[model samples]
Target: MRIFLGWTLFPVWSGWAVTGPKEVTAKQGSPLAVSCSYKPGYELYPKYWCRPGFLRFCFTYIAQTNGSEVTVTQGRVSIRDNHTSRSFMVTFSGVTTEDADWYSCGVKRRLWFNPQHSMEVMVSPGKAGARRWWRQWQRQHSRVCLCLCRLPGRGERSHHRAGIPGGVSLGELHVPARR
Candidate 1:
């Protein structure tokens, strides 16, 4: 049987657990990914991601990998399981303010406790929010490296390296993380 007391859902069975980052941040209109990992023995079990609203009433399958390494995509979201890593990843193609929600990742087991964990996704506004986030991150971390490179046999060689208060653009992380 399944039990849903409130926001959290607990199943009556084994006591297996899954772990992952409890919170993730993303900028609107950019891509975001959340990963949940399970123990070794559950590697072959199907993995799924969904919003809690589905667990108690709908019993729906948002995005699931039928115990396979292949990725599953539903609309703008996709779920991929990596057996070797014993983890599953869910990605959102274009994040919006409405996309910010509490999501769950689970390893599905028949007649057994399905290990699951909740993740909170926070989406910031547009470019302004991204710049604000970058500035805040810069304040928290003391070290950010900036590097410039040129071809091996080029004309005059120029090298530049910067530490903490270095200069980085929206393209710093190389991922549209700031876009």
Candidate 2:
């Protein structure tokens, strides 16, 4: 299993406040769950999951409901909003490479959609060959430390550090390849 953990900070001007990991990494054909916590003011607002469209502001909504809990089997996605907890969760079952994409957790308003948080879901092939290649690569570059940052609006940027103690090395990271 491969896991990618990072923080995705959102600017306060986004309207709604949400907190969750910046990215999620999972193996193909695996089950994965991600949760987003929202501000108390959005408790009664409908929550939704959506995929990014070609246009910057366009979104393809997967499923949404005003209820506290809703599930969609056709999409193999399930969502739950806990009013008492002030948070919502989305779960994906039997995820495939095709399922990898940028998704947003949003709150529906009267006239607009407020995206609280966004994430890039990456599904790895999970083949043994890939794992072996990663291991070999790590052994060859043991002294370098790499940090990947996902900047909003801008694309991803990586920073490399050398001879830093207690920093992440090559083998400790896993980035899924595009299919």
Model 2, residue pairs in steric clash: none
Q: For residue 172, what is the lDDT in candidate 1?
A: 42
Q: On residues 36-101, what C-alpha lDDT tens digit does candidate 1 reach at each position? A: 888888888898887767553215667889898999899998999998988888998989999888
lDDT of 1 at 29: 91
What are the runs in model 1 whose C-alpha is more than 4 Å off? 1-16, 54-58, 128-179
Tens-place lDDT digits, model 2, residues 1-179? 12222112323445357677789998887898988888777788788787856533436667676754555443688888888887888888988889888888877767554656778999986676478778777666455545565545667565544443223543354443332
Best by lDDT: 1
Q: Per-candidate TM vs. native?
A: 0.60, 0.59
| Highest-scoring model, TM-score | 1
